[model samples]
Target: MSFYLSLDDVPDLARGAAILGTGGGGDPLIGRLLVEECLKNGKKIEILDPTEIDDDDFVIATAMMGAPTVVVEKVPAGSEAVRSLRALEKHLGKTADATIPMECGGLNSMIPLVVAAEAGIPVVDGDGMGRAFPELQMETFGVYGVSGSPLAVSDENGHTCIVDTGQDNQRMETFARAVTIKMGGAAYIAEYPMSGADVKRTAIRNTVTLALNIGRTLRKAKDKHLDPLAELSAFLKDTIYGHGTVLMRGKIVDVERFVRDGFTQGFATVESFDGGHEMRIQFRNENVIAHKNGAVVAIVPDLITIVDVDLGTPITSEALRFGQRVAVYGISTPAIMRTPEALQVFGPQAFGLHEPWVALEELSAAR
Candidate 1:
């Protein structure tokens, strides 16, 4: 828990984090970059185990909400992350003994580190979601009946709203998204008030260590020109959840993004260079479903990633475009995401697809 991770170690951690995210947390790049910048400025990220805290110590999960697309255009002023957590502490009437990274993907993962450093608290080494997802309530926190209400969200312009929604994490999510859009499409949020024992019961533990291990492995693979994918598969062993072929390779032809019901909804078309197939990828901040050559190929609860094979970098759902020869990879999902409630909120049907929700791995293996 005392280890200080360097900027170079972020990718593997993020990759592993994404797997844990289980197709819900947002992208990890923004989070990695933010953490890296903090380290560059001589900031140190402290990791803590839930057991290290006192039973009654205050703990909170933190993340960002709004359009991931808008975040690139309007970079946070660096202080916005910490501001939301600090504000929440004032509202809760106690100093947070530790800051918990709400989820382990994209910007949310780094939000708490900055808050922790500024507050001089240790950042809990675990997170609510192992991977990324769009909805606030779709986490182990949900599994344990942790309502994501009573949240504090803030924008760069210094607009802060302390919400007390009781049990309506979804409605709270909707409300926060609206405010975030009006404020320019992205804002930081502090949510899920919990204690140490509750933290262990509801959180995914030691993910930071797993992330560090994965990051280190990927770096070694890169240096050795080893097949990063294969190395990862071997390293993960039983944990590789899902795997699938490219289905089809192509450049992105078009993208349609719009904010509705407090979520960014859209899709992209990848015209296969092989000239015989095509891929249609759909998402809501997080990649949820993908189709190939007019055939439904992949669906949520699983992970679909479009990596520039040559660059070994992931393409954000927004940056996906036409004319780039890309390789798409699919990962198996954890069984929990298949829960009816989880799927109703993020499945293929949730994205407006008529196909009955089918797990991607099943379809991929069948192919």
Candidate 2:
């Protein structure tokens, strides 16, 4: 379908996108602001279902990769996202019929709205991964036997890298990460290239519509002072439900952050709300592990999200701090997150752990 999305749809779409993010889409607030700015400047975004395009139509996925903390602080260079799209089109020897968010979460979701509007192309109502991941080659496109190589990664400075390792996506990941390191630790990018028809079989259908709905629900719940968490639980419980645990309802006492070797690293401790219990959180940007009383409770792939009980919003791993009262919720692992390949890809061991990774499934069943 040849349709353009407007600013009015941002709220629901962004919210719903967060839900599909299932606990890991970076953050959407800044992306919404940037997208709205683009919209105000006479940009237009079109949305299309995967089936709407011909089998031969070229499809690409775009997302911003880097420290989410850095993204919010710097704001995107504005034109970088759109320019990357245009640059890829020129490099591909074919203009993309559509651009979709590489995944439907955080800033990536809203980035496409602006990119599509500026480029006058339709944003396909689909994505490579239904949720966010921490790697370059971890998108569903790879699972479907598609390679991220032949990828064109462009930054805000007109510096571009044409990547085609001919079946080596990890090399592409390494190459892109090196670029990201030089791009001030955050770079706007559009990667996966596929056919409208080819992606339909692997892409999550109607996710954009679902994201819009979730956003609306959260908004209504907030205005009414209803439990936004409850509203979210009701909306996605079946697909993303996990054991509801307070983990350690506490106040953060200290936070230590260091940009070690160009990547953020740190640990935080939260003293119990009851003042009798305490917990420690470790991270490499996103929450990776949570421990209470020297016993491991919540682990990766499971939602270790910290939300302000009163504010009803999430606090990301990088931003965890001192003197903040928060509730840690244990949400189920995302569908894509549970895949053996995925667990292996983002497993605890992969992140420099000496211990074997604990499967979320076993963790869930044990309780």
Candidate No. with top TM-score: 1
Could you give candidate 1's per-residue lDDT for residues 1-367 as a string of tens digits?
4666666666667665554443234556666667777778777777887667777777888777777767767777667867888788888787778888877665666667767756677888877666567777667776677777678889988889887778887787778777777777788888888888778777767666766665566567878988665665566555434343445556767778776665666877777776777788787877777888777787765667676665444576656665666766666555555667666765666556678877765797678
TM-score: model 1 vs. ground truth: 0.87
The alpha-carbon root-mean-square deviation between model 2 and the true structure, to one decimal in Å, is: 3.0
lDDT of 2: 0.69
lDDT of 2 at 186: 80
lDDT, model 2, position 119? 77
TM-score of each model, in listed order = 0.87, 0.86
Candidate 1 regions exceeding 4 Å error are: 11-30, 50-55, 240-248, 259-262, 344-354
Candidate 2 ranges beyond 4 A from true positions = 1-4, 12-27, 51-53, 238-248, 354-367
